[model samples]
Target chain A: MGEKVLMKGNEAVAEAAIRAGCRLYFAYPITPQSELIEYMSRMMPKVNGTFVQAESEIAAINMVYGAAGCGKRVMTSSSSPGISLKMEGISYIAGAELPAVIINVQRGGPGLGDIQPAQGDYFQATKGGGHGDYRLIVLAPSTVQEFADMAGSAFELADKYRNPVMILSDGLLGQMMEPVDFKPHKTEEELEELGKQHYDWCMHPNEDEPNHHHHEINSLEIDPLVLEKHVIHLGEKYDEIEKNEIRYEEYNISDDNDVLVVAFGTAARIVKSAIDELQEEGKSVGMIRPITVWPYPYKAIADRITSKIKKVVVFELNLGQMVEDVKLAVNGKIPVEFLGKVGGILFTPEEAKTKILENI
Target chain B: MEVIAQRPKSLRDIQFTYCPGCTHGISHRLIAESIDELGLRNKMMGVAPVGCSVFAYKFFNFDMAEAAHGRAPALATGMKRARPEMHVFTYQGDGDLAAIGTAEIIHAANRGEHISVFFVNNAIYGMTGGQMAPTTLPGMKTSTSPYGRDEKDIGYPITACEMLSSLKAPYFIERVSLLSPKEIIKAKKVVKKSLQFNKENRGFTFVEFVSTCPTNWGLDPIKARDWARENMFPYFPVKNFRDKSLNGGE
Candidate 1:
């Protein structure tokens, strides 16, 4: 922690990216995530990084694909409708095994829903939004500080796996301002070390070398057998990711609890408030707040289930997307219930409390 | 046994997958020769479009990326912006450039991004079985335009060089033909000049090669060239639209 300063979540992510030595930023203007791109536009020039306001979201993500192919730490941010346009490029990036970070500052949507907070992109982020057998290591941050921190963490995860990582945030998180402590900027030498990590496979000039080799950043494999093998190799990586990267926060979880609540992102924050009130009223409720929603903390939710726990309940901003994950985790051992609000509205703690009590 | 001409150092020894008599082979040779002639072979990176030239990554003996349909310019923009010191270019077909990727090509040129774009206009989509392309002639018949293209329905052919040159930023824009031996010789100079401009960091160099799709056009190699000269040349005339260097004072 260097110093605590007040910052919007979107601006904090931009600052964190710059501090983490991400110099290539390409994006289009969208409502909830515009501040992220706007911050990069103003700051990238000062740091001598490249920033382009691309023609559209599709172009922006493909630009990310190009930069990432060269082993440059690149990022693009978009809202929901804009993100739909980017799926084609994201699929290519995943198939090419390039390391890139995407920030989806989600607005409400099936299509251009509204410029308000919603967790509707949960399926789009964790499951494949793009056409492929791939997953984006999704980090759902509940607070501005976590949102800022996940920027650096997302880059690390992307590089570690040589896959794309998405920081799934929503309008409420993007617009909210809170105190945040950013890590120190990476030194010149550290940035150089990071750049070298992918040189063995990345596209770069090897002209002067005795053995000049070429690198192709491509995803098209016409041969079905070869593609099958490649997909299986990707599967192995996903398995490794699943084994090592499942992360969640357990709040007041114990055997004595009557009901277990599952939620993530901003919904989890509201649920925590509801749990606090429930405890005050002599009712015990615990929450499992998933941080990494892809290698979803399924076992964590399962292991915490004691005989005393009556039922499991899920709360979300969307019309019950994560509830499916909750049901899969519960595995029919316990009854699972869900309560959700859609169309850019967030359920209040009182509403959450009533839902939890109903499940109890 | 003196070797007067051998393969260009910038191209691999592997065989091309293009259909017999397709001008993609000619276009690849010209680009490879241009990179080799400029001595930028080692520092060059190319982007392959999602068309007949999608396997261009395998053909070009350098760093390359294959972009999605109509998105090669955007990909090249990213590559150039990432490695400003390294030379970058995109090899795109008419459908990839003029049709699906109109936004990307226009914006890349308008921004004067430091990259070269080689647009191959054969007037039809050869990879997807001769469908009508944005550069298809008004009355040209193809798989999609079975009854000949109607201007009211499909619209006129896009002259990419003219459209791109109208922008205030591109440093070079030229359209050349590979319809005949003499035209090919002329096309090579334009290709080399575009790469030279790229090497010199002259912004957004573009050259559209009026190429032939012999197999798709149901013509033999010789007749395809003759057909292109007769049918394609009038609509997509070979000309230099803009050259910043010729502007005298910038």
Candidate 2:
């Protein structure tokens, strides 16, 4: 076991990112996520890394794009409105197939909705917000432990798929503190080796060979035929990701359960508490918590659901954003219901239990 | 045998897609020639902004990244900071550096990031077909401004050199022209100096070229050159606004 430290979700994620070999970070100050950038500013200089507090979110995302192109492990974080400002650069990074990590500590949105936690950015994260046929490997973490843990895995998956990875946590998680055991960090020698692995494509120049030439990180494909092929190739990669990277946690899911609950991020944590209370009362309620929201554990949901289950309830802090995915997974096999608390107001376990009882 | 000018090895054999009478070709050759003269072919990195120069990655033999419009300076800042050993620069057009990317250019210059910027101000959006640019002249008739630009409605063209020179951080800032042979000779010297300063790790350097776009301007190549000299030179006034070396580079 690693050393356990009580840490806020934001700072833990930032520290874990440094441990995972992120030597460069760029960000603009936004509510609920400022701790991450502040922590980075102090620690990065100590480790001889860089932390650039950019003028705006647009500039910050572009800086990540530039640093990532040079084969550096880089990151940036923002809230809902700031992520909207970063959309163009995000799309370009995904289109260029450069590896980067973006943390969207989600707050209320659609237009600076509020400073509190909300899962309103679900569709934007999973469906590729910016223009183009691309996908972000979105990880929805419900606990500070998972939030910190996803930092390392996020960079690993980004490099493995050559795509952007998003840590989509909400403000509650960002501000809350919990004891988390961190993973072992990458050494400077390991990071040096990682740089050598990207020699074929990084922007730091390359030797010209029969099949090799100068490196370029670009998203512009003027030729339609060439672009079509590139999009198809991206689709193939997503298909492989869906096959290999579906992560979820099943709680009290058995044949005896009549109600199945689906949720992710902060809402999932609430759902788990509600299910535990309901189970104590002898009510058969189970929960399925999605870890990878983009590759979304559809098979896990489909597999656990049987004729014995009478209702599938989806809960969120937004106006029914993730319920659509739950319905798509349920596929008319059972009645799917939604319960939402909007405007950044969080629902407690007791409130969630009431809603679960009403829906059933 | 009398030796004629041959293409620089720093430029790839790819043909430029620039329109006739466009000064992008001339500007590219100047950059390419400077790269060859300094022996920086393998150590050079560039960021191409989204404009007529978006495909600049295809012309230069060195590694490059295509940035979101006006985001080239931000990208170059990242590259130079990450790999301080490499020489980094950005090639941007008017609509890119002045219009959509105004904030990016200003902040990057203010930070004094160690990178060079080559800005081409042709007063119109060339790739998107003759729209009004922030550098567009008053009374100029572009596709968007068919009845001539109104300085009252839309403000006058920004003089980037003058604006950037006011900042305390920049190491060098110059506005040059490409209208005539004499201007081109002087412009080459400035471009070479920017590249040299970059190699020396001298801080943020910017060189703006008041260029011509005959296709967008609805003029012949020679007439476009004449129009630029008459209109652009008066407003932009080819001059060096700031150079650290002017005072022995403190």
Candidate 3:
């Protein structure tokens, strides 16, 4: 109902989820993303939604699986280790073809490495956190507005694809405050209509209708041929998503640019500041931000490489995870260089500029 | 043509893969009968766990979900919450419930999630070939406990009914044996009662069937039944641990 309000990225995500008709939320409190869960806990009941503070991250994700299977817009939030704990459930949800949203306000990890902000979960979120041949629709939000907007988009994509969608934000975005607009909320009527979308596949024990078959939500395929066919079917779905859903944002990538900087989320924000300083100093530098981390905007980055641009620079808050994607995108068209800050350390805009300047 | 004994409409027309004399088929029939008798066929949703009864979803004519290991309770919780209008239940075995899924079962019961749980306690892991379960009787020999279950090394068999009874949120908790015709009749009543409670949207309800694993127990069907009756009934007594309806809630 609010036209404009100053909100934290985490809170904005929670508010956006509520507006998008996320009626069921399950979570266990984790650092950097605690506000999201707390906001859901407070707001869900008021809106006649269910909020469960589950026993563990494992339990929370499973609860998401349950609600999603029942054709409810469900979500869960957690930090790095918590997300790792949820991998098993996530794999199951993916295998079962359930639509749900997971917010990983990532922090330092490799095993509870630290509580500070980091982008170390790039591989986990995009490639596969769980043990299956699966991919989540990964969205990386750099601003509070994007954080809020992506929550709505996440549900849409998830429902459209019948897959899990993740908001892969770092602690910086989660903790930082910015003005956000919460409008165009899914109305009560719209929400009711949305609930009807999954009626065909959702678990409804409609024993009265003789023609209606039992909707069994399971991933186990016993026969080898059947399992292979199922996996191929899922692969086809992912291929469709890949063909349709690649999203990114480009800044100042005109012909004058000698080097292109590729980044995402908080790293992109820092990279933007660095690019600004570089441009002011008469350097040809631009930034390409991949908003959707999964469908990693390879073409967007690749298409920008002109005769003048000789190299691609990737700066991330992790230890060169997305750089691999950048390199693959470049495909030897130009050399790809990586600059990273790990262990909860965020490189300053000046430090990033220094790296870019040295690279050139 | 008199139909004194026929498959319940809630059951699919398929032969069970269970070992001859295994109580899973009987238990499935009783549950199906209850669903039919209660007229809950259209609204019944079942979650089958990873054990001998993992294929329970296939046997049950109603809509069902297959969960990993002991996560059936968690899966059922999601189903019940998302669609409260549908009656949901989880069918789990001893290893899946008493051991690996201890947390899920306990917490779901504690939260008073509107779901019924059918726990089959047969002391051994039937699906995985006689591995020792948490409900394995002390001194009982299982594949994992070749030398017999040592209480010091691994705690004594957990009594599921007794454990769940301690939780205040649960509306009903009962344990029954499936060793004989008489006991089977009693177990059926408990199953029906649990389902009835679930139909009313009463909080968490549970029924533990003290069953036999003839193949896993390396005994004839009759011998396995006798063994369970002699060894397990005394430990996991057949009775309701908590009935909030009678006492008018906790």
Best by DockQ: 1
Please report, as a residue range, the 10-residue window in candidate 1 chain A with the lowest summed lDDT: A204-213
Note the residue pairs that clash in candidate 3: A207-B42
- Against the hidden true structure, what lDDT does model 1 obtain? 0.92
Consecutive 10-residue window with the lowest summed lDDT within model 2 chain B: B241-250
Ranking by lDDT: 1, 2, 3
DockQ-best of 2 and 3: 3
Candidate 2 wrongly placed segments (more than 4 Å): A206-212, B1-4
State the lDDT of candidate 2 residue by residue for A1-360, as single tens digits. 367999999999999999999999999999989999999999999888988988899999999999999988999999999998988999999999999999999998779899999999999999879998899999999999999999999999999988999999999999999999987778778989877777788977555445336778999899999999999999999999999998888888888988899989899898888898888899989899899999988888888778788889999999998888888888889888888988899989988899899866
- Please write out the lDDT profile of model 3 over residues A44-76, one tens digit for every residue: 999988888888888888888878888899999
Q: Candidate 1: TM-score? A: 0.99
Cα displacement (angstroms), candidate 1, residue A345, comes to 0.7
Q: What does DockQ give for each predicted structure?
A: 0.87, 0.71, 0.75
- The models' CA-based lDDT, in order, is 0.92, 0.90, 0.89
Pitting candidate 1 against candidate 2, the one with the higher lDDT is 1
- Report chain A TM-scores, every model: 0.98, 0.97, 0.98
Candidate 1 retains true contacts at a fraction of 0.85
Query: Which runs of model 1 end up more than 4 angstroms from their true locations?
Result: B247-249
Clashing pairs in 2: none
After superposition, candidate 3 runs with Cα above 4 Å error: A205-207, B248-250
